[model samples]
Target: MTRHPVLEARNLRLQFGGVTAADDASLSIAAGERVAIIGPNGAGKTTFVNICTGYLKPQSGSVRFEGREITGVTPREIVRNGIGRSFQLPQLFLDTTVLDNLLLALAAREGIWNTWTPLKRHPRRDEMLDLLEVIGLTETAHQLPRELPEGMRKLVDIAMALALRPRLIFMNEPTSGVSTREKFAIMDVVIRALQHNATTAVFVEHDMEVVSRYADRVAVWSFGRIGLEGTPAEVLNDPDVRRGVVGS
Candidate 1:
């Protein structure tokens, strides 16, 4: 028996004025797969992810999750339907402690806003703490996002997305603003957390090494389309990809 893909996008097309963001774009992601979308800037990688997560609506085509259409759903509807995403830039309440950041995420997941309860006293405090521990951010739990380094801030943003308990998560540029030495370590923590939660990952990445080390497969986005999809070695080593994407 053939299992339906967990997420499917079919011939998605989107445009902004004269710029084409997605042009006949389509892809399918299976459960448990770590898929990487790699390309140069403005190649439609982030645009596709935005469409899937409902942050941007496509001009045409459809996005389906678990065999149900969700192209026209709102972002919150997509989240409730088990899809979540983190942005290229870290999005967090910089004034709040990391723990409170996650506590708020947990509350949002349950649609429990407007509570006067303190974060420390939230019902899911322990669960948020465990999530922090899983992502190697336990020690920074009490630190504000402004106090932590960029890498830690990225992880906190991702953890907040995870708190929503998504079946599939899209991470846009998961390793964009970090020291070279810390990129691998950051990805190690993020990937392990995704695995622990049994979530499928689809990340947009510019770093070929990150894609090589972490992705089960890769899709090369070029000029608003995926020109190739293969294993890391296969995609990264292709002559066209090396010339077009890697610019080598």
Candidate 2:
């Protein structure tokens, strides 16, 4: 039997007026692979993720997941189809408890009417709790997002995405805005949780430490396209990658 790539992008291009955010970018990840996309500040990393997650429509190219061509799917459709994403900045209803947030994501994953109706104690709730435990936030499940530390809040956002039971996840700067001490810890929890469940993770990160430690492969984007794709050690040490980060 032939196994298919969990996600794939073919000649993806995202342009804004005369500016090209991402141009002719192509990549693939197999099931359970933990890959990192690394580049300098304006390397179009997030633009690639936005197009993949359906938040932005690319001017050209195609995105396919699990053999289905979903070039211009809506974010709702993408999530429903088993692709979930976490924002660079944690996007949470600040007043809501962590439990409620997870429940909301679960409800959304289950569909529309289910979200409005009172959430019943179900198997999914147990699953959410298990995820909370993994992210080290189970003890704070009743706390509101504002009460948690930045790292924990990031974890909560990730947990919310995990509740959707996605096959692939796109994370934009997963460790961005986090302190150096907590950055690696945050990535550890997120990577471990996803890999434990056989989910493919594609994250855009500026921290080479996290990339070296967690990424099974690294793709360096430069000049609106991919400069190199290989094992972390291979890509990171490449002269082109070094020049891209310093020169771009």
Candidate 3:
């Protein structure tokens, strides 16, 4: 049985002045699959994500989610349609506690425009706590973002994204700023949480170790296009990828 793709982008083209960010990019992501997008510094991996997530409108292309065309939709609209994403930097309310941050995200997900409203009767406390537990941050739920370490901060951001209960999530460099030793720890918790929720994931990653361990499939971007798509081993060992992406 063939499963339909949860997200699909075809013939995506985007440009920023003279630089071509995405050129004829196309990809399909199946439900519950973990995909890693990898390439060198300016290969357009993040640009493609921005386009799909509605942050950047492509000059030309079509984006479909769950069999519906979503190109040119607003970010909030796309998120409401079951797509969510976490940024490379942890996007959180630094002044508030981790728990409160998740609460706000939940409120926003429900279209509660008054974020300042009292959360005493927010009605989603248990759900937020479950998300904290999934990210292994239940102990620090009461702490503010600044008080938490880098890795935990990242987890909190992810937890907030999960608060929306998105069917598909895009993670931009989830392990970027954390120390090497803590990278796997963060990814372990993240992958486990995704599986627990049965959510599909697409992440832009530079760490080959992380990609080999976590990614079920890999997409290699080069000069604004996906030049290679295959298993981690296949993409990692390819001579072209080795030279262009890995800088070997």
Q: What is the C-alpha RMSD, rounded to one decimal, of candidate 2?
A: 2.2
lDDT of 2 by residue, 115-194 (tens): 34576464468878888888888899898999988788888888888888899998878787789999988888887789
**Deviation in Å, model 1, residue 10 alpha carbon:** 0.2
**For residue 71, what is the lDDT in candidate 3?**
94
Cα lDDT of model 3 by residue, 174-228, tens digit: 9998999999999999999999889999999999899999999999998999999
The deviation in Å at residue 234 for candidate 3 is 0.8
Model 1 ranges with Cα > 4 A deviation? 1-3, 113-116
State TM-scores per candidate: 0.96, 0.93, 0.96
Error of 2 at 242 (Å): 2.5
**Candidate ranking (TM-score, best to worst):** 1, 3, 2
Please give the lDDT score at residue 171 for candidate 3. 95
Per-candidate local distance difference test? 0.92, 0.85, 0.92
